[model samples]
Target: MATPPITFVPSPSYEAALRRAAELWGIQLEFWDIFGHHHVASPETLSSVLRSLGVSSESAQSLNAAIESRLWSEWSSPVAQTLVVSLSAGAIPIQLKDSEAGAEIRFEWESGGHTAVSVESADSIHPDTARLRDHQLIRIQVPLPKEATLGYHRVTVSTAGGRRAEGRLILCPDQAWQPDFLRRGGRGAGVAISLYGLRSHRNWGCGDFTDLEHFTQWASETTGVAFVALNPLHAIPNRQPYNTSPYLPNCSFYRNGIYLDVERLDEFTQSEWANRLLRSAKVQNCLAELRAAPNVEYAKVWRLKLVFLKLAFREWLRRNPQGTGRREVFLRYIEGEGNLLHRFAVYQALDEAVHKRDRNLWIWPDWPTTLHDPDSPQVREFESTHATLILFFKYVQWRIDGQVSAAQDFAQGLGMPIGLYHDLALATDRCGSDLWAHPQAYVQGCRVGSPPDDFSPKGQDWAFPPPNSIWHRDSGYELFVQSIRKNS
Candidate 1:
């Protein structure tokens, strides 16, 4: 049996209304292809996109209703969904109705601090006063306090008439910081390397932080390079042929433990068991084979590092009592990371535990149904029972941070303006920790890709889910911002 081609026979007015709805929703009706040919999206495509955006576009009546509802939602809102303002900016932009002109605006910081500002109309008509129904919208610039710092904040507008709405505010600098030389029109260059491919006698099969630090120092003195650029350094499954690519990481928020230099860790230095393991004949032979290998043995390197790292962590626990110096520092770092770190640690712990029990179960979805969701009761119980294992993962990230920070400081001390330039991968492994942790932050049924280009005439499908823009906006882009902050 042959399937017939479907047809859409919308009326003229309905077609126009549909196109209008698409435009309002920021869907492009026309585009120029790679071959310089102009293309217009079909009505079917427009409707499909609109549907994806959660718009009601089933028919003329539904689309018209959706447009009206969207407009009213936007116009009646007390503030924009999100606002990015410079620290030196005079005021923050807000929208309000004439009836709610006397609303009180509150500025709340993420650090449990807040400041209040009054919203008083200047009696001047805003340019956006497109009248909606019987009410008119007014735009006002609420004065910002001078002490407002650079970070994410929240804004709430409350009126005496019982109307209330909230929005997100991101206070940032006018520009990113750069060295004086670059700001003064000086040209600079640096070498980029895949850290794992850097061969050295000291590194155990793969390049570690110590290798990077040493390279930075050598490059500063010999190559005269301004900085060293490295690959994503994102944590991966560390498996060959499939999961070793840095661009598709198991966890973007944390670094791969394989990059840790076991010989240099404070815990390793303090632990007798770690020292003996490092010097053992079996460990030495494994390290030598890995170091001399033609390619980076990702699995071997990771397995070796895991053994030493676990030993070091156990030693630290035995020596550093609760509330002690290094223990307190480690706890503080975890506290600062908050739930994000906790979730990543939980995922890593689960990954290890599940694989140990059943080697065939590689991904989270293959696990028991109750353990699939991060917020499930089973997961909570796992966290309680596997607290130390989760902490070990966090400990790995903390040490990586310390070493990278030290390298940056060392580079600056030696006159290299930027010590380590990190590249953050935009794509996350679908079967990785990120997707398992916050599945709602991504859209299903479609993979993110680029249009046809010179290199890839057929176009490219990256095999990763596109982020849920609506979800990020509603959450004030906390996860998105955290990704960049963690890499930095």
Candidate 2:
């Protein structure tokens, strides 16, 4: 077959603007194509990419305009979203426009420590000034003192106009902490597995937390294993077939409740709920289909597992509605998780409710417009009205949490160096709960995945929106921290 030709070549004038615009917006336009062809992205592609990155670069005039706006947005704005400083990277630079030449920049450290960056004449720290947009942009060099601690800090820039811009000052280390056992590093063996692959006699179509514990114990006892790596074990709605990929999870913070080990549930000991749940004709039929199939029947497994979980949950609640140790532990987790957990639970409930009304409306984008905004009055009303359903989601998460905690404890008891190692996804789906909860924090048109490679030809687009680089940093890398901690 003759290869199709690439369209939308750039003119010289347009090309220069595109190049300059791409440089400013940090878009890579010169990726090699699938056929070992070296090609530059066309003007249209560049404009679209730049536009997605929040740069309005559609035309030559607009391109220049966007560049100017970016200049002010980056260096000339009162401040950036954040100033990331790593001890390995040494010093950092701060910038402001000519009008704010004498702005007072201060570092308010966590140890009751402080650094005042402004002094008379701006002479104390060498200031480099360049002219752009008819104004001088000054870059001020600031050095971190050796005594500075590793934590989130605050940076404030107060301009001459009495205007103040606040930004997060993230101080990262050269490397993440590795335990002494890992640092010593002898030839310790490890294994990775899809959680669903740990099948057994009683699993509801797929593996569960109980299987993980058994596997971990067996691995540790039989082989001197250090860790067990897992693919992204993210949450999905109880809805069938579409909740397929772990990589394309609805929420990263919460585990897929389908992974809950129903047999190991406290409710099993409390009454016949566990036995009755397993005995259901629909549940047994689905489980049989899943177990007999070579590959996972994800839809069947999800439906069957959800039914069992809901039944188990109701049974547990009946026995221990309040004043129970489980309730106390769950409450403690909620307290620690704070807004993050609550918001995820609310998103799940809203997502499920919306899906029930219309199965085609699985994603938040397709939902009623008002429900998109997490904090909108309509959303708040929906939450209030469907409070029980939201709490059910929370209960599911808590149940999952308990089982995961047990798995970790089991591994630790078995003397494994690292009980679990979770793989983090590069980005989240725009249609998923994370993006729906924080829309502005992600790029709309950009995807996070590999470029064109020989195997499949046309480059892979994961269809996940990359987090806004500026916003992620501005968040003091909170999302990244949360992901790592939860997965751990």
Candidate 3:
């Protein structure tokens, strides 16, 4: 039998490096020059190659002894190599030189030292014209093993002409876990309707905090309900006509300052003009009118509340000329909470940046390339200028936290088993704090939602980004734990 011709094309240094590597490994390489083509020998030809490389028996034995004593870490660098692994299934379909004539392309996985699995390419899979033109992407569904670890996996594609292309598979860890509170049953007790449905005469158009309080008191005393779960009371970006949905709020951390009780304003009592206005029975009349109404007109309630909130904010600021100590306490609370508060504040600042049009915070694709780098001066400056805004947002969150705690305390006092079980939205808003703070953790290309089932034929896109498993692991689940603790 004639041996296949193999061509060996190597620079002098390259050949020396190959010899050194083989010598260190106690292995011999069978270099064959087949006509003009050079090919490395198969595993079976390794012994002959070793002898040709001048690796004597004694030297090989010494190399093996040295290798056995060295730890694996000494040989394998932590820096992972990128490998292009291809996977396919179903009918084996391949594209030949002619598009009309298809051939079978064998697919296989060889995770060095592990059993190989043969895969069949699907006929339905076709080359993407745009991707092919750009030579940027390959369209193929790769089947991943259930036990694959998180990191880079190697993949190789081979064709008849000995052509090969390499790509990397980023295997992310599966850190999917059921939320602690979720395991305890969700919304099983009865669903509560929005308070916006309640009618009030005092309100300019919609319900107010007073109305919320009144309803809570009523529900607690009459129905023995301990907790009254309300939608986020976060401030709205627009005040002229507030948005009807509670889900899309300007800041989840801040109390809708509009909901503050006007009657509770301390400075209002000191103002003769305010006193006269109140004495005229306007305030009393509004409350009396709301008491008589059965349903809330949000527009009317908001109109009335808007006027009151503006007056209250002004009066409160005037009364606290030295700046309220509450601000200091709020700042302290956020700092104590660490990254949770810091990230929330960053989101709030980003929101303001979006509103002011000073900087494009959301989907800023056109931003200078340098700003993406963490160590860039531009990012540092942005962080510095927006630091106060972030703190302000944190202050708002502190207020909301206090309010929630108070509500829960009130409910507990009434002997409710669950006290105040707050509802967690299915996912965080894409442009909100979570996504903004941890952009790396979110998948931007796809929205997270459930597939269509018997319940509904139309699938839903919740418009929220699900956390990336890699990001969560790298962060040590700090964000996850903090979110749970805060809500709990």
Candidate 4:
């Protein structure tokens, strides 16, 4: 990628414009592609932009036009006009156009090992175009052929000038959704062990996914255990002396990538040093000895694994290029299922946050004015720079997911009724992604906890925010259902 040129700007007016736009849109807008071109717009900015576009004076019409116009203008002129072809869709309202010759749009797909393209709009989409006083908006709803592949399919928008815009349509598997095993059958007939708070010597500095997997394997083979309940594997902010508690993770959906088993990298390729290390009598004996041991020494194991995993990741990247079809699918999964992923990313970001102590959490909000709002431009820029760290978190979760699934498959191969069951934390940290992302859904002041009873005299304040019962009820427990679905 080429580095965009930076241009200096006049101070007061430029700063005023940015503030005005942000206030109007409720989002900070900074231009990266356009040098020194900062145009931030909020809902209010939409209204302002619409008025400037000569929409009807009625409030309702103005609001609607404002929204549509703003969305359209965001991609207009230099962004759109320069393109030989353009494409867009969904709630963001994708638009594709060609400046030269007006061309007929075509849709294509492979059928029975042969490629085909649509001849007419009636065969698939309703072709429609709208012309405003100064601009044109084209709307086409292209329908896929019945024989279209059940995964990802490309859609192409073409113009007469031979210019084209390409986009994708993902077709998810048409399987019937399964309810959580615990929910449907009431915990089943299985022994439940709390794996939380177990000390492990093999983890880096804290118990990790490797420990969980090892325990699951042992529980399955030695005892006929169907489920291994463990603590939340959420990403902790990368702060040194990392957060030791599992329940207070930054992101629940995203896996803490650091927990990826380093041993697996050996399967990728041949390295003299690695091969020799594995073949050495000392290393061989260590592996053989650990196989007979009941538990792992986490710190030692992690240190060994980290050394190899880095080498493997480098080799893997060298063989596979970025933005490939596989990579895109992976990215889509993250974007679609990223609420939890974002949490993990936020956690990692906090670890790298400025002032070392400021990990995007409120230690004492009043102390640092700059660190107060997470949505500020400074924070957003920080996130963009460290976006790869977030992706790393997602990749790690994917690897762990594969391992856990393999464990389940192994149990099922032996004809077990229930394969695997994972434990979910009762609540998330108040300063974490869950609370920050869904502010309206969380009650900030009161923390979730168990009331005092026979077990203990004083009530417990877990220091985590519980889902608002009222909101859950009204939302048909969608959050709960989604969480269960993800775990299952």
Q: How many clashes (backbone N, Cα, C below 3 Å) per candidate?
A: 0, 0, 36, 18
Residue-level lDDT tens digits of model 3 in 101-183: 22222223335432223333333345421112212222233345444444444444443334344333444333534434545
For model 3, the stretches where C-alpha displacement exceeds 4 angstroms are 1-191, 195-209, 232-244, 247-328, 357-391
CA lDDT, every model vs. true structure: 0.83, 0.74, 0.47, 0.49
Number of the top candidate by TM-score? 1
Measured against the true structure, the TM-scores of the candidates, in listed sequence, are 0.89, 0.85, 0.47, 0.49
Error of 1 at 21 (Å): 4.4
Instruction: State candidate 2's TM-score.
Output: 0.85
Which sections of candidate 4 miss by over 4 Å? Answer: 1-222, 236-242, 257-259, 266-312, 323-325, 353-374, 470-478
Model 3 scores a TM of 0.47
lDDT ranking, high to low: 1, 2, 4, 3
The 10-residue segment of model 2 with minimum total lDDT is 1-10
Worst 10 residues of 4 by lDDT: 83-92
Residue 109 shift from truth in candidate 2, angstroms: 4.3
Q: On lDDT, who's better, 2 or 3? A: 2
What lDDT tens digits, residue by residue, belong to model 2 across residues 1-488?
A: 22232122233476687788787567777866667788777878777878887777667777777666655666665666677778667555666655654667787887787887663325535466556656666766556666567877787878775767878878888888877786787546689999987778877667888888888888888876888887778886545555677877788778887788766777765657668657789667767778788877766676666666667777777876679997787678778888888889899888778878897886788899999889999999998998877877888888788888888888878887778877776666677888887777788887776766777567787778887776677677788778878887
